[model samples]
Target: MNTKQMIKENNRLQDAMKPDNLSYYQDMVVYIRSSSVEESKGEELLLEIAQHLLDAQAKGKTAEEVFGSDPESYCKELVEQLPKMKGLNRLQYHLMIPWIALTWFFFVQALVGFITTWTGGPVERMTQVRISTLVLIAGGSYVLIHALMRWMKNDTFQPDEARRKINVRSMGIYMAITVLILIAGVWLGRLLPVLTIAPWVSLVLFLVGIAGTKFLFSSK
Candidate 1:
């Protein structure tokens, strides 16, 4: 089955688990899914584990009895054994978020420029390319992805109430950090050299972003 189907099956199976076993099994689910293993393999393993746990439960066994007490260590071992994503696939995965974000950003800029030019706004001969803004976005996205992975790893061990609190706190911190990065990027952009971009350049950039996204994500 595909990743989505496996996940759906796992979810359906988990509904029958005893409370303690469900909690234990969910910890494994979170940790395994958070790892860098290929999605299909990860979900397949999760579904298989869910099936095994259900069978064990039917035999009057606990999840701890079946998989041992240390879910984290067991999950880590399983993740290590799973095949990692291929190089191109990994690249596409990492770039997907930032690529979509930047594309939409440039698209808005292009659309505004097109509208302004048609509406008799001043057409400038040059436009500023904020290198630092681009840098901040790319760097920030990488940091956020790693942060989320770490959060998932740690949060899996926490009680539900505590995990909810942590989620709220983490989101606040992330938003604060994003604001600071934007401020810093604006400052740094002023210190960098400006690029010469015509009034119509944003439109070109929008088209390029579309083409580049297709090329990068296209199947081999």
Candidate 2:
């Protein structure tokens, strides 16, 4: 089965597990799927593990007893054994989020320009952004994502309630940091060398970004 098929099957099988068992198993699932391992391989391993867990459940075995206490370590071991995404594939994987954000940023600017022209207001055909602002936004995004992934890895072994709390707290922190990044970018943009981009250019870039992103992320 493909990754999507395995995911659906895994979900159906997981629904039959006891709440505690499902929670425990899900941590491993999240950690493995989020790592740099190949997608199909990761989902295949998860489906296999899910099936094993269900079989164990029939014998009244808990997830912890079946998979041991250190699920994170087990997942780490499996990730090591799995084939890692490399070269252009790895580049595409990592750049997917940032590319989408940049694409939408251009799209919004282009839309605003068009709207201004249509409304008979001052023709705003140009958008200016500073080099320093671009650097900070990209660097900050990478750091934030890296930190969040680390948090996910570390939180995998915690209890269900604790995991939920961690996730909520992490999300809050992530949003707060994002706001700070945007504010800093705005401040730096005012002080740095500005590059003016035309609406037509932005529209072209938005189109290219969309096509590139679709190519990079499309399921094979």
Candidate 3:
């Protein structure tokens, strides 16, 4: 199928599935990509898995039965079976790691800062930290947005203008969210007290949150 056709089919499949099932499939796709599978192959794998789910549902089976009780393990097995790509695809796959990490790092810091603010942490110290954190957040946001655009442009699976536009729009939404969070953090830092926890403890908490969120979203 052509790129537009493929995207249409993908959208149809996603719309047909239950929300939880769609989320499961989306998570699986993310996991597969993060596992170093090439983008085209990842999309092919997702389409195959999505079809299986639809067929199972038609047979009156739950998504759990279709995907198995342990979706994470199933996805890992799929990743293991994928043939490694060479050349630019391989390079792009490796590059995605640090890009994703930087994005997650900023996201975690923003979330943690918001938590600290809501808890009545001291405003003075937080305001001081916010300066540096904001700078890093802006840089991280730019890196993430740029990486996403580059990925979309280079993706072999969705080379059509339609798919590229869709992907860019999604990235724009994510950027908007990042901007809002940064703004909120700045305002909150000015209003709240400094956190009672030590810097190390807070750092630990941020790491934990980043790890958990990454696992859930990327599963890598």
Candidate 2 at 50: error in angstroms? 1.2
- 1-220: candidate 2 lDDT, tens digit per residue: 7666888898999999999999999889879877898888888899889999999999999998998988878888889999998897788777876777778878987877677767876664346656775678567867687778878777878878998999998989888888888888888877889777767887998999899887778655
lDDT of 1: 0.80
Which predicted model would earn the best lDDT?
A: 2
lDDT at position 174, candidate 2: 88
What 10-residue stretch in candidate 2 is worst by lDDT?
121-130
Q: Candidate 3 deviates by what RMSD?
A: 17.0
> What's the TM for model 1?
0.67
Please give each candidate's TM-score: 0.67, 0.78, 0.43
Scored against the true structure, residue 216 in model 2 reaches a CA lDDT of 78
Best by TM-score: 2
| TM-score: model 3 vs. ground truth | 0.43
* lDDT tens digits, residue span 66-114, model 3: 8777776787788888877678656554555444555455555556666
Residue-level lDDT tens digits of model 1 in 7-84: 778889999999999989988988987788887888889988999999999999999999997777888889999998
Whole-model alpha-carbon lDDT for candidate 3:
0.62
- What shift in Å separates residue 56 of candidate 3 from its native position after superposition? 0.8
Local distance difference test values of all predictions, in order: 0.80, 0.82, 0.62
